[model samples]
Target: MQVLTIISGVVGIATSGTEVWHGIYTLPLPVMIVALLWTGARTREFFAER
Candidate 1:
């Protein structure tokens, strides 16, 4: 799911052409990147908790 989100976000940004820098397409990339980092940080704890 996380990988899919990143892939789709990149695709969306890439396909945006001139609008690639627009907020709608650009905002999620940073958010998702942060999410990926957060997930990596928590992975061990998350599985341990599960």
Candidate 2:
């Protein structure tokens, strides 16, 4: 959930650069990738905890 939120936020900022600095484009892709992997890790951990 957090990962999706972050991705959406980054995408929003990237698409609408007026909100965040235009230079933010350099970071979102990497951050989004890590967020995706983190989400997967947390999801697996959740299942493992059960």
Q: How do the predictions measure up, each by TM-score?
A: 0.37, 0.35
Candidate 2: pairs in clash:
none
Highest TM-score among the candidates is held by which one?
1
Cα error of candidate 1 at position 2, Å: 0.3
Count of backbone collisions in candidate 2? 0
Over 1-50, each residue of candidate 1 has an lDDT whose tens digit, in order, gives 65566566677677867665563555676777767777874676777755
1-50 per-residue lDDT for model 2 (tens digits): 54565666678776885766643544566677776776886768877955
Candidate 2 C-alpha error for residue 42, in Å: 8.3
